[model samples]
Target: MKLSDLAESQILKAQAEGQFDKLKGAGKPLNLTADGGSAEAIGFRIMAEAGAVPREIDLQKAVQEQALVLKETEGEDARKRELKKLADLQMRLEMEREARRRFFGE
Candidate 1:
Protein backbone atom coordinates (compact mmCIF):
# COMPACT_ATOMS: atom_id res chain seq x y z
CA MET A 1 0.00 0.00 0.00
CA LYS A 2 1.03 3.61 -0.57
CA LEU A 3 2.28 5.80 2.30
CA SER A 4 -0.91 7.84 2.02
CA ASP A 5 -2.96 4.67 2.30
CA LEU A 6 -0.96 3.55 5.33
CA ALA A 7 -1.39 6.90 7.06
CA GLU A 8 -5.08 6.91 6.26
CA SER A 9 -5.40 3.37 7.61
CA GLN A 10 -3.52 4.29 10.78
CA ILE A 11 -5.79 7.29 11.31
CA LEU A 12 -8.86 5.14 10.90
CA LYS A 13 -7.48 2.56 13.25
CA ALA A 14 -6.76 5.19 15.83
CA GLN A 15 -10.23 6.59 15.50
CA ALA A 16 -11.76 3.16 15.81
CA GLU A 17 -9.69 2.57 18.94
CA GLY A 18 -10.88 5.92 20.43
CA GLN A 19 -7.32 7.22 20.34
CA PHE A 20 -8.14 10.61 18.79
CA ASP A 21 -9.93 11.56 21.97
CA LYS A 22 -8.70 15.15 21.90
CA LEU A 23 -7.79 17.83 19.36
CA LYS A 24 -6.57 20.52 21.73
CA GLY A 25 -2.95 20.73 20.55
CA ALA A 26 -3.38 18.87 17.29
CA GLY A 27 -3.59 22.10 15.26
CA LYS A 28 0.18 21.91 14.89
CA PRO A 29 1.42 20.79 11.52
CA LEU A 30 2.23 17.15 10.98
CA ASN A 31 4.55 15.42 8.50
CA LEU A 32 3.23 12.09 7.29
CA THR A 33 5.85 11.31 4.67
CA ALA A 34 9.63 11.54 4.27
CA ASP A 35 9.75 13.78 1.16
CA GLY A 36 6.83 15.88 2.47
CA GLY A 37 5.62 17.14 -0.90
CA SER A 38 2.00 15.93 -0.87
CA ALA A 39 0.10 18.91 0.58
CA GLU A 40 -3.39 17.61 -0.11
CA ALA A 41 -2.58 14.15 1.16
CA ILE A 42 -0.96 15.60 4.29
CA GLY A 43 -3.99 17.79 4.97
CA PHE A 44 -6.32 14.82 4.67
CA ARG A 45 -4.03 12.73 6.84
CA ILE A 46 -4.02 15.39 9.56
CA MET A 47 -7.75 15.77 9.46
CA ALA A 48 -8.18 12.06 9.81
CA GLU A 49 -5.53 11.94 12.53
CA ALA A 50 -7.41 14.49 14.52
CA GLY A 51 -10.89 13.08 14.80
CA ALA A 52 -12.75 16.29 15.64
CA VAL A 53 -11.80 19.93 16.15
CA PRO A 54 -11.86 21.31 19.65
CA ARG A 55 -14.65 23.67 20.69
CA GLU A 56 -13.87 27.24 21.70
CA ILE A 57 -16.23 27.45 24.64
CA ASP A 58 -18.94 25.89 26.67
CA LEU A 59 -21.70 28.43 26.21
CA GLN A 60 -23.74 27.54 29.27
CA LYS A 61 -20.81 27.58 31.67
CA ALA A 62 -19.43 30.75 30.12
CA VAL A 63 -22.72 32.58 30.55
CA GLN A 64 -23.10 31.43 34.12
CA GLU A 65 -19.57 32.49 35.01
CA GLN A 66 -20.03 35.88 33.38
CA ALA A 67 -23.18 36.49 35.38
CA LEU A 68 -21.47 35.43 38.58
CA VAL A 69 -18.52 37.70 37.86
CA LEU A 70 -20.83 40.65 37.24
CA LYS A 71 -22.69 39.97 40.45
CA GLU A 72 -19.46 39.91 42.46
CA THR A 73 -18.29 43.12 40.76
CA GLU A 74 -21.47 44.98 41.69
CA GLY A 75 -21.31 43.64 45.22
CA GLU A 76 -17.74 44.82 45.62
CA ASP A 77 -18.62 48.27 44.38
CA ALA A 78 -21.50 48.55 46.80
CA ARG A 79 -19.32 47.46 49.70
CA LYS A 80 -16.65 49.97 48.77
CA ARG A 81 -19.15 52.84 48.70
CA GLU A 82 -20.61 51.83 52.03
CA LEU A 83 -17.17 51.76 53.60
CA LYS A 84 -16.33 55.20 52.22
CA LYS A 85 -19.57 56.66 53.57
CA LEU A 86 -18.91 55.17 56.99
CA ALA A 87 -15.41 56.55 57.03
CA ASP A 88 -16.65 60.03 56.09
CA LEU A 89 -19.27 59.96 58.82
CA GLN A 90 -16.69 58.87 61.37
CA MET A 91 -14.37 61.71 60.38
CA ARG A 92 -17.16 64.23 60.64
CA LEU A 93 -18.09 63.02 64.10
CA GLU A 94 -14.45 63.22 65.19
CA MET A 95 -14.24 66.79 63.92
CA GLU A 96 -17.44 67.74 65.73
CA ARG A 97 -16.15 66.22 69.00
CA GLU A 98 -12.87 68.11 68.65
CA ALA A 99 -14.67 71.43 68.07
CA ARG A 100 -16.90 70.85 71.12
CA ARG A 101 -13.92 69.96 73.28
CA ARG A 102 -12.10 73.10 72.21
CA PHE A 103 -15.11 75.25 73.00
CA PHE A 104 -15.62 73.60 76.44
CA GLY A 105 -11.92 73.52 77.24
CA GLU A 106 -11.98 69.73 78.05
Candidate 2:
Protein backbone atom coordinates (compact mmCIF):
# COMPACT_ATOMS: atom_id res chain seq x y z
CA MET A 1 0.00 0.00 0.00
CA LYS A 2 1.06 3.60 -0.63
CA LEU A 3 2.55 5.47 2.38
CA SER A 4 -0.29 8.01 2.23
CA ASP A 5 -2.81 5.24 2.83
CA LEU A 6 -1.00 4.19 6.01
CA ALA A 7 -2.61 5.27 9.26
CA GLU A 8 -0.60 8.41 10.00
CA SER A 9 2.17 6.42 8.22
CA GLN A 10 1.99 3.41 10.48
CA ILE A 11 0.94 -0.16 9.79
CA LEU A 12 -1.34 -1.45 12.52
CA LYS A 13 0.71 -4.57 13.13
CA ALA A 14 3.96 -2.57 13.12
CA GLN A 15 2.47 -0.11 15.52
CA ALA A 16 0.96 -2.68 17.85
CA GLU A 17 4.05 -4.91 17.78
CA GLY A 18 6.16 -2.13 19.30
CA GLN A 19 8.25 -1.79 16.12
CA PHE A 20 8.10 2.02 16.38
CA ASP A 21 7.65 2.21 20.13
CA LYS A 22 11.30 3.15 20.73
CA LEU A 23 11.74 5.55 17.84
CA LYS A 24 12.47 9.18 18.72
CA GLY A 25 9.38 11.40 18.84
CA ALA A 26 7.08 8.50 18.16
CA GLY A 27 3.36 9.13 18.62
CA LYS A 28 4.09 12.83 18.12
CA PRO A 29 2.71 14.92 15.29
CA LEU A 30 4.73 15.56 12.15
CA ASN A 31 4.94 18.89 10.39
CA LEU A 32 2.75 18.50 7.30
CA THR A 33 3.49 20.17 3.98
CA ALA A 34 2.54 23.86 3.85
CA ASP A 35 1.23 25.80 0.83
CA GLY A 36 2.14 29.40 1.59
CA GLY A 37 4.56 30.94 -0.93
CA SER A 38 4.60 34.60 -0.05
CA ALA A 39 7.50 35.96 1.99
CA GLU A 40 5.16 37.44 4.60
CA ALA A 41 3.39 34.13 5.02
CA ILE A 42 6.71 32.29 5.25
CA GLY A 43 7.90 34.73 7.91
CA PHE A 44 4.68 34.21 9.84
CA ARG A 45 5.06 30.44 9.54
CA ILE A 46 8.64 30.60 10.78
CA MET A 47 7.56 32.73 13.72
CA ALA A 48 4.79 30.24 14.47
CA GLU A 49 7.20 27.30 14.21
CA ALA A 50 9.42 29.13 16.70
CA GLY A 51 6.50 29.31 19.14
CA ALA A 52 5.41 32.91 18.82
CA VAL A 53 2.04 33.71 20.35
CA PRO A 54 0.23 36.90 19.27
CA ARG A 55 0.22 39.97 21.53
CA GLU A 56 -3.58 39.98 21.51
CA ILE A 57 -3.72 36.48 22.97
CA ASP A 58 -1.14 37.39 25.58
CA LEU A 59 -3.12 40.46 26.58
CA GLN A 60 -6.32 38.44 26.79
CA LYS A 61 -4.62 35.93 29.09
CA ALA A 62 -3.29 38.80 31.19
CA VAL A 63 -6.80 40.20 31.54
CA GLN A 64 -8.13 36.84 32.64
CA GLU A 65 -5.36 36.40 35.20
CA GLN A 66 -5.84 39.94 36.52
CA ALA A 67 -9.56 39.37 36.91
CA LEU A 68 -8.89 36.16 38.84
CA VAL A 69 -6.50 38.02 41.13
CA LEU A 70 -9.05 40.77 41.65
CA LYS A 71 -11.58 38.17 42.76
CA GLU A 72 -9.28 36.85 45.49
CA THR A 73 -8.00 40.23 46.67
CA GLU A 74 -8.99 41.47 50.14
CA GLY A 75 -9.30 44.91 51.78
CA GLU A 76 -10.49 48.07 50.03
CA ASP A 77 -6.96 49.27 49.19
CA ALA A 78 -5.85 45.92 47.74
CA ARG A 79 -9.13 45.45 45.94
CA LYS A 80 -8.83 48.87 44.37
CA ARG A 81 -5.29 48.12 43.22
CA GLU A 82 -6.34 44.78 41.76
CA LEU A 83 -9.27 46.40 40.01
CA LYS A 84 -6.96 48.96 38.45
CA LYS A 85 -4.65 46.25 37.21
CA LEU A 86 -7.54 44.29 35.82
CA ALA A 87 -8.85 47.40 34.08
CA ASP A 88 -5.45 48.11 32.57
CA LEU A 89 -5.17 44.56 31.25
CA GLN A 90 -8.69 44.67 29.88
CA MET A 91 -7.96 47.98 28.16
CA ARG A 92 -4.81 46.60 26.60
CA LEU A 93 -6.67 43.50 25.40
CA GLU A 94 -9.42 45.60 23.91
CA MET A 95 -6.90 47.82 22.16
CA GLU A 96 -5.12 44.82 20.71
CA ARG A 97 -8.39 43.31 19.54
CA GLU A 98 -9.42 46.60 17.96
CA ALA A 99 -6.13 46.85 16.13
CA ARG A 100 -6.50 43.31 14.85
CA ARG A 101 -10.06 43.91 13.74
CA ARG A 102 -9.11 47.13 12.00
CA PHE A 103 -6.22 45.47 10.22
CA PHE A 104 -7.92 42.15 9.38
CA GLY A 105 -11.55 43.26 9.26
CA GLU A 106 -12.59 40.49 11.61
lDDT of 1 by residue, 1-106 (tens): 9766897998899889977666644556565564276654554455555553212123334445544554555577776765565555556556655764575477
TM-score of candidate 1 versus the correct structure, residues matched by position: 0.30
Tens digit of per-residue lDDT, candidate 2, span 1-106: 8544664555676678887577544577543445345554554554455466778767878888888899999999999999999988888888987886676566
lDDT of each: 0.56, 0.72
Candidate of highest TM-score:
2
Candidate 1 wrongly placed segments (more than 4 Å): 1-74
RMSD of each: 25.9, 14.0
TM-score of each: 0.30, 0.54
